[model samples]
Target: MPVDSKLTASSEKLIPEKQIAGKLLAHYDRHARTLPWRAPPGANATDPYRVWLSEIMLQQTTVAAVIPYFQKFTTRWPDVSALAAADEAELMAAWAGLGYYARARNLIACARAVVRDHDGAFPPDADTLRSLPGVGAYTSAAISAIAFGRRAVAVDANVERVVARLFAIDTPLPGGRREIDAAADGITPDARAGDFTQAMMDLGATICTSRKPACGICPLREDCAAFRTADPAAFPVKAAKKAKPHRTGHAWWIENGGDVWLERRPDKGLLGGMRGVPTSVWRVAGGGEGDSPPDYPFAGRWTALSDPVVHIFTHFSLALTVHTVRAERDCMAGRDGEWWPKADLASAGLPTLFGKVAAAAMREELPCP
Candidate 1:
């Protein structure tokens, strides 16, 4: 029997779900990417801790960037109970270079929740898993399916692209997400659901890539609506992006005898629970005007530096001017933070934004009086 080369638009002409699943599973059996977090095909399920950790770290971050961090975290804290028991500061420092500091905070909270509520075992069902901190729909589904062998559809960006192309969904995302999820649900097999989900992810990551998808060798090419149209990459249509808002602020660089002033950010909001230099509050333009300067931490001989540190966040861009000051040795006596040795700034666990600020200060060689 021959599969249809061109699928009709009618309901009866929809691509056969079994054929797509069989072909994709066969391809996965041969070409699955050997990630540190995933178990081998037909092997026993992977540790739930590894699965959950990888999923959280991989959010809005590339796998290549996450590999070392994942290895470090697992080596340091192998199990949920260990992670739950770890100190918050140590965990935040370990996660310093990894952006999205909020995730680190939530990771600790979720770990503690798991240890307290679930006895250090992650809930096996998707709905129950979502109740845990920071675990959203996609992550919950992924954990349930991959870690517990439950029948669930875990659609990440990769799987979204693959599904959108498979069905030739022209509606732009997030609008198209519903249709993509539906299509994914329809094709997901009753058995080996975990492998099927991972297979879809692998296919999207390796073959059905966002740019120049290898449609010729794709397992589901015959059933792919986008492949038949000769533009498989045009799918998972996205809405036009609005320009990110820009903001400007200042960071005080107060140094005394080879030590700099650093403070711990509040345990809530942006850069939460991380160490950084004192700075102005980030503000949006009001009535088409720049914001007023924030109050200084303490009066000192402050000199403005020409260079500014520019950092981009998920929702806004920041330009922080560095105000160098030679604070008297006694001035910082009552301050809440430590006077960290300048030589050891690398280990200060500054968020990437503040790290850039430190680099700018170093480049200018702001002398201490």
Candidate 2:
């Protein structure tokens, strides 16, 4: 079968599709990474639930970072139905420190969607998988090919780099992404599409790395255009990045008796649906911490700590001023969130930003048991 016509027109490079797939597959049989979500070489595919879960957890996250989380999630929820039935707050808590709060939200939505719309079975077709929550083009393709053995083009960051180098496409990223997609379609084989996609991923991760690709040992080196140029690392040119805008906010540590007041952020924006200490709105500043601190709901004499809690997000950098105040039980009456025991703050599942604030407060004031 021919490649996607729309992408074909934009493709900057063409290769021997069958030969490339065969070489990569042969290499994969001997060196496939022993990941929990994947089947061993020549084995039948693993569970779709495992494929779906691992793909979600791996988004913008590294394998080293995701392994423990994946194990924890599978151990706790087991399957789509169990995940669908999980309490939202508890699930969000379990996902704390995972970063990318939106993915956690979509994880819930996607699990519920799989159970509700597809009868707890993920759809086998890539296009159909795209309809599920959090399953975008790359993710849908990965799941369809890897889990369901469907013929689909899966182009992730790793695959993108490998293809960019193999073809030596010079167009910088974003603009070149379409060309990469087309090139990927050109190489994806009809049989063993899952294994082929995975081989490309493994090749890119272990060999075609960004900075210093090990071209001498790479299985595809002979077929690689950039390798002929002797500078495989120079391919996949990227546009320069702009400086991330700075933002400032204040996290209030309202401790009463032995407990602290914490609230769930609104479920529509950053850090949504997670338990955290009360925080003022986060706004972009030209530079430096913004003019002054935001006011809190409860009234008390506030003690502002000197060191700020700093965190870097995708689009912005944030510096939160930490404030602490002891309050009477009545002062927090009718508040919107729960008063978590200060000693068991670890169980509160605070997002990283708020967790930092809590740590800062505890360091200077009360130490947990």
Candidate 3:
């Protein structure tokens, strides 16, 4: 049934908030995403620990990628105390392939903080949750609303998009975030806020997507101003993307009989706390970076692979030219690194970029003699 509904606080016309909340909640009751970290819609209470963990993992990562990781982490560390007590190296290894390595570091810090500062239980309010490590505006709001059922407006990327389209806010993001936040606040109901926020997220994820929103069957179709317009996807206007800078570096690969020398990255900058092949400083490509490899970790005969290992990060793309060294077992004595058996390289906690370099450094690709 179509009914006039209030979508934002400052809209010109009058529409009922109850109408919007009722329809959205009804839709959520019928079609909610069954995620590992989520409880049933009307369960007594959701585990705040799981909520916090999932929210942390889901930052800048997709649900599909997070599912297996979430399952593995939950299986290994069943509770907050367990995670707080887990080994940093083991945790970083488990978090190997997941980009944004800083999140993993923050995860450990947040867990420890929760245990030490809050007595192993997550505080229920947004303000208190914000005090914990790595729990920012969006994260704290999500924890509060989803875990505690507070009326905190949790506007993640999905919720932001949904709110932007619901009201047809044509303002570009960053600049328009204030308006979007206000509109999200307006739509958040006084009751069942957790369900309401989750419903909005579901609506954005499943129906009102970035491309070709399913306006015909959307639960809020009647109330959506963008749906009334032909091109609903364009409502959430985004700023133009600037080109990512490019960087080039050299990696030193030392392979003995069947073992490889791996170095742990310094615990400060990019890919920190992960074990990977030794590498030289990364400099911007073409800015004095020539086709020739300039430096090596040790003085030895090195064979540089013709092709470079290319990996993209949020801010830049990297091209690491791998140079392999055939050396004796003790040749890596000067370098503070470990010699791991090639067969167990999978267990090594190499970041994705380094993993690519490692693959290129392997001798397995050649045909058997």
Residue 130 in model 2: lDDT: 94
Task: Give the TM-scores of the predictions, in the order they appear.
Answer: 0.92, 0.92, 0.92
What's the ranking of the predictions by TM-score, best on top? 3, 2, 1
Instruction: Write one digit per residue (lDDT tens) for candidate 2, span 21-132.
Output: 9899999999999998899876665799999999999998999999999999999999999999998888999999998888889999999998888999988999999998
lDDT (CA) for every model shown?
0.87, 0.87, 0.86
For candidate 2, the clash count comes to: 0
Better of 1 and 3 by lDDT: 1
Q: Which run of 10 residues does model 3 get worst, by summed lDDT?
A: 1-10
Clashing pairs in 1: none
Q: CA lDDT of 136 in candidate 2?
A: 96
Runs of candidate 1 exceeding 4 Å displacement: 1-15, 285-295
